[model samples]
Target chain A: MAAEVVASTVEIAAASQVGMKALGAGLAVGLTGIGAGVAEMGIGSAAVGATAENKDLFGLVLILTVIPETIVIFGLVVALVLWFV
Target chain B: MLAPEKMSRLLIVASKDQLAPITGALYRSRLFHIEDFVVEGREGYDGFSIGKPLAGASEASGGLIKVRSLENVFAIRPDDIDPAGARKRHDDLARVVDRELAKIGTEVEGLTSRRSKLEASIKEYEQRIHEITPFADIPVDLSLYRGYERFAVIAGFVTKNVAIREPAESRIVKGKSSNFIVAVVPNEDRADVESELAGAGFVASPIPAESGMPHALIDDYQAKITQAKAEIASIEMNLDAIRQKHADFLVACEEVLKSEVEQAEAPLRFATTDQTFVAEGWVPSSRIAGITDEIMKASGNRAYVAELPIGPHDVVPVEYNNPSFAKPSQFFMNIYARPKYTEIDPTLMLSIIFPIFFGLILGDIGYGLILLALCFALRKYFRGEDAEYFLKVIRNASISSIFFGVLNSEFLGFAMPWWPPYSFSRHLISEHGGHGPMIPELLLLAIWIGILHITLGRVLGMVNHYRQDHGEHRMKAVLANAGWLFVMWGVLVIIWSGIVMPLMPDLTGFPMLVAIPGLPMDIPGINVTMVLGGIMILAGVIFIARDSILEVVELPSIISHVLSYARLVAVGLSSVAIAMVVNFISIGMLIEPQLENFTLIGAVVILAGVVVFILGHALNTALGILGGGLHSIRLNYVEFFTKFYKGGGLKYNPFGLKRRFTED
Candidate 1:
């Protein structure tokens, strides 16, 4: 009975640590969306301005706007890593 | 020494009846003055002497005479001249002319001085008239039904008989209670009579005369005022023309004096173009290709050209395209070549960086959102390119800030796990000690970020050099950048494992030795690994120092070039330090509590604290961005550019349609 209690306690502690890490990862990625939105705000406006000046820059603007989105992708990767680990 | 010059002339004749048409054709050719002679009994014969040689005309017409001489005509079309050399000559001439004109300007002052005295007398008479008629009002009436043509108007009558003075034609009309008096006079003489009447204790006001006929009493006053104004304007116009001519003459005189007094110089070169002719002067060897191309394009191979190399270095080749409008070219050439043209085009680079840095420093999600909204709204409402550009930069910076804020793990001073999923001991809660994992991690991250940015700059420099065909230099830059990156990484790794102890021990002895002594030696946690880490750090420092010192001597080949990235670290550290300070200040505001009953006061205190936090952080963010962005640009200019950039290459400017605001 004493051994079983000790085992269960250790299992719960391990589960909690994993859960905490997963929570951290999720928060990182979820919060990164906010950051991504903020970044897009600048890029989208710049893209619009560039497009207005020269329609040929549409491709360039689209590419540049997506560059900031990489930050969020990184955050998402971190969350996936934590969950998988 | 002056060299011998050559001359070319052309002569042509047409029927006398066609003289006007032939002259117009010659004018179109931009050739100067044609002399005509009338032959006895030859009523239909006209002859033209075109004294000025055509720019590129090899063929001759039957009725035109063109002459090319060594003497330079002081015409206005300097744009036909080489831009650089012509600009220098123009400036030299302009300075001398300005000095001489300034001396003559004193004479203008004397003429204008008399105007002030006359104006003062006029004002005195006006004041006296105003005093007598203090309570008087001029009544004007317009009626169509007075049995007059179209409309009739009556104005300004006194109940008592005031001695009426008619300066021009006096006319009397019968009225109900008073006799109406009318006058007709020129506008100028009317003003003199008005002043005279004012002096005689009568109030006189001159209104706009009805059609061509004016009131007989006021007509004389209006005529005098008109004459005065017209006289002043004519005098002023003459004065202005004289000033301009004096200036031009003075310039020519000064050039002659400088040549005689200082050194024997070449004759002045002038170029002009008009509806008929395009005249250019002193085409340099470097600019010959461009000028020839322009002429060929404009005149289609029919230009008349003259070449006279009269001075040791003066090769004056003048071409006249359309001479009628060519004089303004000289004026254009005079104001060209300002330093602003060669300065770096800041538009593109500024657009990219400003907002990114601004946002990073601002770092608060809420505040960034607010700024983003404001900027966007302002840009939308104000339809200007500058406003739009500003908004774009702000939006980018805010985005960078949001990213930085995430790394900071802060949102309105609230912790990530607001309702703690699992609470650690409440006893462990201390303001300084309990900061979440973000701060230390961010500090480390900033250093790495600096390294990355510097690497990117070096890579760009390498690419730019390679594009310019400097392969060896590009290779050197790449190697130097790589060496620095390796060294920095190596040192960081050792410090991470041996001293900080947050990560597992990975790297060995050299770093430990240098880091131990360099770190707080008396700190309790100093260990053998720390000592080894210290040694490695010291070695890295020595490597960097050695390369820097050697760069002054043998140019460290490619190894020393990588040191330019140190600015990246410097700016990043500055940003981090500013961010920390902002956090501390904001947190400090929430420290003291108000009395228990004064709950409202407590809320007010919180609001004040929030305000201070926002303002203080916003200011710091602005300063940080400016510092970082400027330093980043400095690093590019001073370090990277010195390695590869050759910025002195001359710019290419093609002649095209230009507008001069000075004429209007």
Candidate 2:
């Protein structure tokens, strides 16, 4: 009887684990996106101001603004692995 | 493919009479880069002084100023007049310019003064009318109020009529809207009465210094003000008519006068010796025949053109000769600095590499197509020289990205049904582990790319150093580069044998068993690869600088530079990952749910998902375009150019006119 009870409890634990994985995936994408937004705020404004003065800097400023996007991308990869894989 | 055009200096000698036509010819050819004649350097030459402007320059300049004033007054633009008509008018203008200007000047001054006089009188009468209108109800002559010797009249508009003490008679005169009070108080009681009037907000009005009734004077002032206004309007109408009549002629006159001044002053840049003039300039080798022919024809064979040898001290200006396909890359190179005339132009190399780097970073078919569409749409609206070049680079990057994206089998981060077995990304993911995250494999690929890129840089550096000279120093530089290459290959092999072999023992045999004898491969922590790499690095340090041991520090920098390419894989992986997440939320969560349930709530969810889908992809595509484009150029500018390029050469700017208003 004790062995049967243990086996049933393992199945429930597995179900909860799957639910936790989904939560973790959501947090990874959401929180990292916020972080990317915060980092981009300063860079994006500075880039715009620079590009306004000299249009030649448009390409350069764009690179600077999207540089922080790598962080969110990392979060996205993690989320995909958790949910999709 | 890689070299700039060759340049040769020229010395042109011509008689003083021929200097004007010769300089004009040079300007017309648009092939000369003139070197200014300094007065201090004329000591060796006989009686050489700086050339003065031609005799006609002063007159032309004076006419230019007048023409500019007329243009401003008439608001005339060159584009508004027909070119042929303007040319004819300009040719005939010299005879009539002075006369027409004097007549127009006098007429404008007369009109201006008349208008000002009318405006001044109108303002004066309007003020008088306002003052008299308040007291129009008094029904008495203005002289009566001012000549009252015993009675003190306090009259102005008031909020209300106030109560006054006895012996002071108060009368309320109706104003335009408010009531005006006339209080005749004795001199002694005036102070007390004025205080009571102040309480009612009374502003005392000064009687007009005239002899007519208040209402009659007000009507007379109003009539005169109206007449003055009508006259001013008529004067303005006449001015406008004059402006319209002269607008086309004024613009034509300005263009003609400006060109005349430019031509007349051309002799100032030449060296003169009372009888003959001398000028020095550089012209491209190919254009020498054309320039010489033009100058000879223009000067009637009076001017001599001879090519002088380039000197060691002379700093020659550089102009690239890249093909049209590689011309756009010159924009990024120009931002750094023009390459020296003697050095290889890196534009062709950059054009090939930059797009490849961008394509590798943004390897998504959907995103690439979106970027390509964006470029096509944006290129139409943008104008100017720089804008066109910027758009061209973006278009090239988009094309390259699309090509690589197809190889990756990624459409908005979702794997396509048809995957090519030969694609690098597909093969990588499949060989490593087709499930879960493939970050480690991506990092490995990025490092391998970094190794290849940096090695190519070192090889270019080797060629550049060897090209400078063939001597002891050249050999030293060549050996130093070779040693660096050896060290790079050695370190990579060490990492493979030492770290990779232990992790994946089945792929390769143990390094100790396969080690070749006489090499330093037997150390415990270090294998044959590590020992060989160390020996090469030490040898490189010695070759680069035999005396200074500090050169060894640079060995680590080479490693770091290679590792920097890891960002390529990191960026591409992140982009793909984000695209997958977008697809999951929009399609999997929203669309799939609606397809399954077909409920009202499901439809609303799908609507929200569509918004998320559009907005999210747009943002990603924009960031990808920006990041991929810039980073690709940056790698060339920062990583690749540092290996071989040394910029700071002056650009070749030929002395010529880029005229838009008039043709030569």
Candidate 3:
């Protein structure tokens, strides 16, 4: 009876481990997405204002606006690593 | 080659009489970048003032305007036509062009005015025909409707049908949108008739003054319109013939006049006195000798040319002297900010690295080929000043994508035929139809890239500081750059031994984490790499603080910048996922099910599936371009460039014209 109880407990622990891993991956992506959005809000508004003034600044403005988006990439990698790697 | 082309300041002092030949020489050589003299300035100019335009500046400018107007009407651009054979002398060309201009002007202007008048008359006739058509069904003539004595006539279309009381005879013609109505009543009961009609929501349509059958009038107007149109066509034909006959002449005249205007106006930028003229400008250092010799020969030894010493912070107009292939990459540097005169130009490095990053992120054979075709197709459309530069950069990037795509074994997010079925870890794609579990390894690879890229920037920073800085400050600037490098490598070593080895080790044969024997090896829990890493970090921190204590606060930025390269892998994987999802939805969810139960409706469904497939991939491709291009360059600008670059260079715009049609 003792041996059967120990094996059953091991099976329960394994199931919970998967659930925890999924939760961790979800958090990683969600929080990073929020962080990236916060970073971009300030830059996006400033870029639009600058572009409005000088039409030729369109190329430079585009690069500035997308810089924060790379932060989300970091989050995505972390999430993928948690789930798959 | 790594820096901007060397610029030497050129100052010229010539007798007032020699201005013509010297100006001509400068204009023809196209080597001078003039610094305009400020006429109103109260500086140390002494008696010198801005020189008057050489001689025929006003006359040349007026001729230019006339030639350009003719050129514009004829739609002739400098680049559109080649220089005609046997160039004419200026006086002859001007006389000929002016005579032709007068003849063409009178003929073309008269024809145009006549055509416009005919068009206006046609519009009026057409309007009359439309107004009369509404009254077509009414048999009453125009005279009978208008000349009513001792009777009131209300004629218009009405919305709702209304009954009229006694004294008015109502004639109604019903039509599609509204009904045409005419009421004739005694003059005494006119108000009553008007009130009744107004209650039914009446609208008025004026009858034409001419008395004729509606059909007859329409036929007459139509004949007139047809004649007018024929005349207009003849006018167009005449104009086109004129354009064809004199197109080459107009182009030649315009080129000569433009050059004349440029050369005549050259003295506006020169400082002058009553007796002599002085000009100052920058020329390429190597070309200065050649230009001086030419100017001396042209002026018959009357002009004196001297090279002035450039100050430390003097404004130097930078012209890049990159190799032919690397020329296109200067577009990116120009966009961000051109490098300073004394600074190291990172354009070549950007040219080589940015494409690799783009390819790595958008690595798929299908996307690569599509982009290649797109770049080729778009090459013709973007003919602005920098179109070739943009197209070449994109083409290089597309080729890189193909190379990286083959290594990734991904053909539009699906496993390629060469993708190893047994060895799942070898390729970036999985046989099971999704991204592989090698994402961590890719991320690590990106980190390594970051490390090397940042290291190069830091080293360049050292070189820039050594070159630009004066004395003691130079040593400090270089040491500060060295400190950053130390911190970057030390952090990488620490992470490699402490984190990468223990947590993510996919490749067994990869080179890293080789523990060498050292004094710190005896420590129970610590290794030599970690000990060395700690010492380096400490030394780096001290060196950095020595330059500016506040700079130590930015130390973590180096570590974060390294982590920023993780985006290279993360972004690519996201693109792959999108492509795969699109493929799965269109082929599996849409097409495959319809094929299983093929029917008449199934054909439509399959068509929809194909459209969905194409549209979805199109969306993915656009995103791939934006993500791959912007993010890849952003890494260079924000991470790599910040370490070294301080760009505020002006472009070298020489005073003379780069003649496309006429040569001096």
Candidate 4:
């Protein structure tokens, strides 16, 4: 009976720990995604206008459009670290 | 591989009459990139006005315009005529071009005019039919509606039937979607009746001056419309036949005339006088001898070719001088900018490094083999397109992925059949007979890669500064490059020795260099690595501040940029995670449980699992490619190129026509 009580308490602590890590991971990705979106908004519009003027700018514009996405990838790495490590 | 091809400025001077032969020789040599001769209005250039085109430039230009117009009329494109197709020989091209152009132009004009006439008649018949269509329901003579002096007829479709409180006769026909009403009122009540009808949303259409029964007239007009359409189709067929018969001759004519016009107008770019002419251009040093010989032979020793000394400040055109294997990466370099002649071309380095980064991210046996197959398949369809170069880069990357996949022991997202040697899987542990949750090790690996890549960039920056700057400035510039490296490494060492090692003992820190492989060198023992870190940071800050004070603000970027390479591990992990999740859902949860039953529902479950597996893996594959390719290129362009490369060199364009459908 004593051993069962200890095991139950340990399980509760583990559950809360996992839950907190999950929350932290969620915030990391969500906030960074928002940041990346804000960054891309201005660049994406300007890239479109430039591409309209010169179609050859399409490749450069595409690269520029995706550069901010790297920030989101960084966030993902952080989230993985929080969850796994 | 690093430097652009060397060029020498060449000057050609000749008597006015030898200009044509010299120009012709230059065109045929195809090695000279002409520098336009500006009229400076001083000294030797005072009498040297822009050269006029030789004899037949105008005539050739006019013929070219006609041929181009004929091409437009027939909608003929370069793709329509195969370059290798055996063309009919025209012994006298000028006569043949003129004769064919005249005959085809007249024929097309005649056919087009007839078609337009038919189309116009068809429109007229349609308009007459539209006016009579609404009136057809009313049994009235159309001439009686128009030629009345004392009576006015108001006839149109309406929303609802109006109570015409006038000495009037009215008929209402209700259609499916709307109501059609026609009314005729006395002249006195015409205004009143019209207002009442207008209140019901009545719109009046004018009657046509045709004296005939309604539906019969409509059928006659419809028949005429059908016949006119057939005539237009026949005319279009005749035009297509003409296109098929004359496509080769016409395209060839356009090519020959285009070449002639360009040759004739070439002199406009040269400086000339009544007695003499001068032309200046750059020729690749390797081809200078052959070109000079050709020019001399063509001019029959009449023109003088002089090799001019090229100054440091001259804008020499740059052609990349990479090995054949590295040539395809020029696709990326050109999208950014071609390197200047004075700077190193980064194509060779990019070709070597980019695929390795790609492999590190997309390393999976199943996906790698699939991508390799996909690249070859795409190459077949995209032949002769710019995309072919990009596809070649992806193919190389796929091979690298296969190599890394073997090392990682990943097949799809599952562990290899035997115990895998290495793993970066997020939750799997070796004790559980699974691969890994080796996050710390992979993160450390990413950091080391970042350090190596960034350091190489700084070292290249030093070399560039050494080549580009002058005297004292060169020293300072090169020192600044070194300073960035020193600061970055110093901060890294401090973090490792003072903070990280004491906290987590699992990460075996990067090895510091000692004297020899077998020798363990002793150091001044009070945490020597940390002390060295402090000293290096101090020295680096001083050196960087010597160049520009604000550059110190950018020092943090060295660390942040290093951390960014963590995406290599992160993106790959995400791809692996997706594949694992898909397999678990489709196979473990859906198919495996039902496989024992062997019932109809079991069969359905297996089919659904297969669909989910295919779709999910396909999605992951697409994501893998996009993430791997973009992140690798981003590191090169944003992080690496920022160190040493600044590309604004002029492209090497020689004055010669690239023909598509003409013979020499």
Candidate 2, DockQ to 2 decimals? 0.14
Q: Return the lDDT, model 3, position B166.
A: 76
Q: Is the docking of candidate 4 incorrect, acceptable, medium or high quality?
A: medium
User: Of models 2 and 4, which has the larger DockQ?
Assistant: 4
Winner on DockQ (3 vs 4):
4
Best of the candidates, DockQ: 4
In candidate 2, position B131 carries an lDDT of 77
| Candidate 4 local lDDT, residue B146 | 71
Instruction: Go through the candidates in order and give the C-alpha RMSD of each one to the true structure.
Output: 22.8, 8.2, 5.2, 4.6
Q: Give the interface RMSD values of the models in order.
A: 14.5, 5.5, 2.1, 1.8
Runs with alpha carbons beyond 4 Å of true place in candidate 3: A1-49, B40-44, B74-95, B129-134, B147-166, B169-210, B244-248, B381-385, B414-429, B432-435, B469-483, B500-556, B582-616
Q: Candidate 2, A59: how far from true, in Å?
A: 11
Worst 10 residues of 1 chain B by lDDT: B62-71
lDDT of 3 by residue, B206-264 (tens): 76787877777778888999999999889889888988887776777776777788888
lDDT for B520 (candidate 4): 28
**Per-residue lDDT of model 2, residues B1-664, tens digit only:** 7878889899999899997788778876777988778778554566787888877889889878877765665566665544444244445676676777778767877887899899999889988888777668777777766666677877777887678888998778665656787778888899899888888888888766777898888888888988999999999899899877776556656666776677677677777898999998889999998999999999898888999999766878888888898888888777766788777788888888888889889977788888888778987687655677777877788788888888787777767766442355532234234544445565566667767777787787787778764667787777777777777776666566555432222212345534454534332354555666667766666765652356566777677566556557656766766677787789887788788868888889889999989888887887787668766776666556776777677789887754444454
Q: Per-residue lDDT tens digits of candidate 4, residues B1-664?
A: 7889998999999998997888878886778898888888434677788899988899889999999998998898866556767654433565578777889999998998999999999999999999888777777766667777778777787887667764698878777766777777778888788888888888776767888777788989999999999999999999999998988888889877877787788888898888888898888899989999999999898888989998777899999898988888998898878898889899999999999999899888889999999998997667454587889899999998887787777777876654545545533434347546677778878878888898989999999889988988899989998999889888877666544532233222434433223322322123557667878998898889998889999887887788888888888888888988898999999899998778998999999999999999999999999988988988888778888888888998887766666555
How many angstroms is residue B262 displaced in model 2 relative to the true structure, after the best TM-score fit? Answer: 3.9
Q: Tell me the DockQ of each model, to 2 decimals.
A: 0.02, 0.14, 0.59, 0.61
Clashing pairs in 4: none
